[model samples]
Target: MSYPHHLGMTVLEAGPERTRVSLTVTPSGLNMHGSAHGGLIFSLADEAFALISNATAQAVAVETHLSFFRAARDGDQLVAVATPERVGRTLATYRVEVRRGAGGEVIALFLGTVSRREKPA
Candidate 1:
């Protein structure tokens, strides 16, 4: 199974330039502070970034940065939306916003860059 599937993440929508993914925090996904682990939030953001970045071409992550704004706890539903900030022949940048729910409080912001790869002839 895919890594996202293992994390119980669902892709709500997907396109070449945009994507939406969701996940519900489980007990195992929580940190010692009784909130969602930063890694879990990052993974959700990364999954959305990966989906949108690779929709039209093969790409690999070059760098990623995530900023946390709020905490989420067990049973909290989170949604991550990714959109391209820029796209070029060799490099692309994306912005991902992770929210508490459909329109809930902002949980985190993620910025990522990927290196595009040529498709096999």
Candidate 2:
């Protein structure tokens, strides 16, 4: 639940292997240039990744790489959908696509990995 609830993030779907999250760009979510902040976009994708990655056990982020295709502006609804690409013994990889609402164009792409933690002694 690391979503920016104060920013009005919406959880469209949450399941074992995939999750969908959304948010509308606003003044607070903007950068100096008046567009949605890149970090904010990344956070949206990361939230989706977090939901799908930690479904089984305690998992923490390993690494992430993101590429922005377009910038979303105020009033634009951004949707992030995360799906598992690989699940290994200890590490898992996921892909998150951030777009402008359903049927909208792709805006950002994110790939992240997380590692499961062992039980405490």
Candidate 3:
């Protein structure tokens, strides 16, 4: 978890099966269009996914699918919430929504699945 970029993300909540993180869009997170870049949005979702998916067990991301609903600009505070769709012994799915903190409009939707792995023997 040495990703320096994530150091800027603030953890709002961390529960056993759910989590929330927030961040304000900055210059480095913007694209040529002056809007938040897709990668940064995706990272916001991914961070939530990582927190919720591994809340109770060891898991690794197997697949992730995301859809952008709206564009967010610099200085916009964004919050991401991750909820579990299913939690099984060997598999899990989470739904992450990135929304503008001020208006609560979703800017990105992310669905991620993970494979739970047992401890090595």
Candidate 4:
């Protein structure tokens, strides 16, 4: 599995059309409200979708829908699991759920779509 190291995040697992990802809350990873930033959570979800979408080949982001259910504060661990919802020749959709670690309280959910690129000739 390939682990992607990005600012404020890290990829925990990458596999065929699926990923298990996590990130820790840091001082800089917070919003004006002193909670984990929404963008950071979304980024983690995006990373999971990216890993799953391009696990086999090339893919590009098409669209995504996300909702924040609860606030993630400092010291809280954020984990996301991405699963394929639909896989077609041109497009793929994935559903990702973000949860609080240890207790498994869902904090957010994301539905992402990607466009699959044609293989090299």
Which should have the higher lDDT, number 3 or number 4? 3
Angstrom error at residue 100, model 2: 0.5
Q: Quantify how close model 4 is to the true structure by its C-alpha RMSD in Å.
A: 2.9
For this target, which candidate reaches the highest TM-score against the unseen true structure? 1
In model 2, how many backbone clashes occur?
Answer: 0
What does candidate 1's lDDT look like per residue over 8-117, in tens digits?
A: 99999999777999999999999999999999999999999999999887999999999999999999999999999999999999999999998898899999999997
Scored by lDDT, model 2 comes in at 0.88
Model 3 alpha-carbon drift over 4 Å, by segment:
4-7, 118-121
lDDT of 2 by residue, 1-121 (tens): 4346966888899976879999999898999999999989998998889888877667899899999999899999999999989888798899999999876899999999999766354
Model 2 misplacement above 4 A: 1-3, 117-121
Candidate 4 achieves a global lDDT of 0.85
Error of 2 at 8 (Å): 1.4
Better of 1 and 3 by lDDT: 1
> Residue 28 lDDT in model 2?
89
For candidate 2, what is the TM-score?
0.91
Off by over 4 Å in 4: 1-6
Candidate with best lDDT? 1
Lowest summed lDDT window (length 10), candidate 4: 1-10
Q: Residue 70 deviation, candidate 4, in Å?
A: 0.5
**Tens digits of per-residue lDDT for model 4, 7-113:** 44567778866688888888878999999999888988888888888887689998999999999999888888898998888998999999888339989999999
Q: Candidate 1: where is the Cα deviation over 4 Å? A: none
How large an RMSD does model 1 have?
Answer: 1.0
